[model samples]
Target chain A: SQQGEEDPQALSIQEGENATMNCSYKTSINNLQWYRQNSGRGLVHLILIRSNEREKHSGRLRVTLDTSKKSSSLLITASRAADTASYFCATDRRNTGGFKTIFGAGTRLFVKA
Target chain B: DVKVTQSSRYLVKRTGEKVFLECVQDMDHENMFWYRQDPGLGLRLIYFSYDVKMKEKGDIPEGYSVSREKKERFSLILESASTNQTSMYLCASSFQTGVSTEAFFGQGTRLTVV
Candidate 1:
């Protein structure tokens, strides 16, 4: 089953604008991660935020997690036209006895230069 | 750098034929997974192996089986291919650190069943 569901099935913005994508999960998660996929390629890991961590940042990517609300958001600052791709949020369910990563349907971001 | 390599970037097979998709990881990770990505389905886990010779089913494991005889290699087998099974297959590997770690994915295999 898909644990995470990303909001805004699609988003389009100017290259200099910031893009935000939100994801909501069904159950408690050990950690939430964001990935980016370009066209027909595989996904590339972006950032991961643990449940105990309210916010985390890497480069221009900032991820915020709200355990109580069961949602997380990814914000890309000063987006570029090269950032046009699909973004996915994944959740690792807590205490499943095994490691299983569930992914969401994903949000397609189109950046216009 | 951790690298996961899928055997093929594209494959074409006939319906009812047995198909095997091979994946190899160079990082010696303990966990390997198979997922299928469709148009609107995102990604659905098919199977995962935590250790050599041990396997577990994921959300969608009906027409698929897995083999992990070696630490670096994992294979996904389709008993009988069908047109419905045509999708992008992704293989990933991650460390078994008791906590969920980052996963490295291959380029994916675009399988077409006709």
Candidate 2:
């Protein structure tokens, strides 16, 4: 089952613009990770934020988690044409050592060169 | 590099034929999963294995079964293929949640059942 739902099913932006996408989850999660998928390829792991972490950053990618609202947002600063791909948010559900990760529908981002 | 490898990049099979999709992870992660992705439905879990010889049914497991005889190898079997089973299949592996939350994925296998 899909635990996360991504907002803005699709987004388009110029090369230098910042792109932001939000994800909402139904249940408590131990951590949330973001992945990027280029056309006709496998997904690449981007970043991960834990439940206790309100915010985290890696390079130009920033992730914010709100346990109170059961939501999270990913911000890509100074986007590039190469950032054109589908982004998916995954929730690592905190269960009895189950280690199950549920993925969202994903948001497609297109960057204009 | 850590990796998950799928047996094929594409496959064409006939309806009512049995099919097997194989995935092997060199990382030796404790958890492995099989998911199917459609045009817009996103990735839906078909099954998962936490340890060798152990399996759990996911949201959509009625038409599929999984085998995990070895820790590094996990296979998805379609007892009887149907046209509705045509889709892209993805395999992923991750360490125990406490160790790492990120999962590494394999290049998906595009299955076409006619």
Q: Which candidate is the best by lDDT?
A: 1
DockQ of model 1 vs. true complex: 0.73
Chain B superposition TM-score per model: 0.99, 0.97
Task: List, residue by residue over A1-113, the lDDT tens digit for candidate 2.
Answer: 68999988999999999999999999887888899998867888999998899999999999999999999999999999999999999886544448677888999999999
TM-score of chain A of each: 0.96, 0.95
What is candidate 2's lDDT per residue for B1-112, written digit by digit as tens?
9989999999999999999999999997999999998877778889888899988887799999999999999999999999999999999998875634688999999999
Q: What fraction of the native interface does candidate 2 get right in terms of contacts?
A: 0.51
Question: In candidate 1, residue A98 scores what lDDT?
Answer: 69
lDDT of 1 by residue, B3-90 (tens): 9999999999999999999999999899999999998779999998889999888999999999999999999999999999999999
Q: Could you give candidate 1's per-residue lDDT for residues A28-82 as a string of tens digits?
A: 8888999999989999999989989999999989999999999999999999999
**CA lDDT of each candidate?**
0.93, 0.91
RMSD of 2: 1.3
Candidate 2 at B29: error in angstroms? 0.9
Estimate TM-scores for all models.
0.98, 0.97
